[model samples]
Target: MGKIPKNRDEALWTLAEWNLSKPEWQHFYSPQLKSDMMIRIAKEWKLDGVMLHYNRGCEGLSLGIAENRLAIAKAGIPVMTFEGNMGDEREFDEARTMDRIDAFMETMGLKRELLHA
Candidate 1:
């Protein structure tokens, strides 16, 4: 098949493989790796930021967004999340989403210019 990652430990494995040392694995095997790998990839591609859908219905998935947010923030990246159902626009509050986004961006200094630029 395609080229496999040289480090198998970094490859996505079962949840059992993810243990108390997950952060250690990330730091050693792939320092670039994070819970927000998708957002990190988008940022590496020079995108402005990442918008995560924090679905209220998906409790398991949404539970880790806060940790992911913290990790992404440590990487000097911006993330904005909105609370809503997967396919129900009626449940999406635009104003609240905008408020969160604005606050996140501000906190990340996304609106600031580079000191040298």
Candidate 2:
């Protein structure tokens, strides 16, 4: 109780670090960390591209996705995003998603080869 913020800014900053509740702080923290993580994972895996799903159903997880995509692309990683809903099929467009995925692959100079399992 004694370890409390003196004012609103301090309080919100603390909360932002903990839960990312403040919008402005979120803008700063989310993009940087998310981008760094994506970049790290891409490097570690020697990935050719990254795919991001903008889930319309979960606003919190979707936050700063556009910024993340931009950052990942800036780091010389091919990145693409498709908007969809995890819990609701109505918000998902399968054809569009597939087309976008194909485009992404094309941009990476990849050609699909069908394999028989």
Candidate 3:
């Protein structure tokens, strides 16, 4: 009645088409694609480390994230993950995220240098 068609028959067909067309975790997908993409990006940019934000709010985007982390590590890239919600501020923990980031930087042999005037 709101977004769908007023007719039940038409609504059924529209909903089916929408569900079938979704490329999310509902469909057959290869995690290797995301793994390969991360690997290529790291190599291309010569990145010292990769930080993956596990957005709790977005299930579709985070589907292959764990596998991607493993694959990136296997490919000899330093990677780390932090969990938080991208859309909701209440779901994010600033202190915990900062701690994980600090650990990641330390693992990468990175240290903050104090700026002097």
TM-score for each model: 0.50, 0.71, 0.71
Tens-place lDDT digits, model 1, residues 1-117 = 234545656455434356523654443344234464655576779866677777877665565666676677676666677789765778889888777876767676755243224
State the TM-score for model 3: 0.71
RMSD after CA superposition, every candidate? 8.8, 6.7, 9.9
lDDT (CA) for every model shown? 0.62, 0.81, 0.78
Instruction: Say which prediction, candidate 1 or candidate 3, comes out ahead on lDDT.
Output: 3
Return the lDDT, model 3, position 13. Answer: 86
Off by over 4 Å in 1: 1-36, 102-117
lDDT per residue, candidate 2, 10-114, as tens digits?
888787566753444454566787677678889999999999999999887788899889999999999899999988989999999988988888777776552
Candidate 3 residues lying further than 4 Å off, grouped into runs, are 1-28, 113-117
Please report, as a residue range, the 10-residue window in candidate 1 with the lowest summed lDDT: 24-33
Residue 93 local lDDT, model 1: 92
Model 3: weakest 10-residue lDDT segment is 20-29
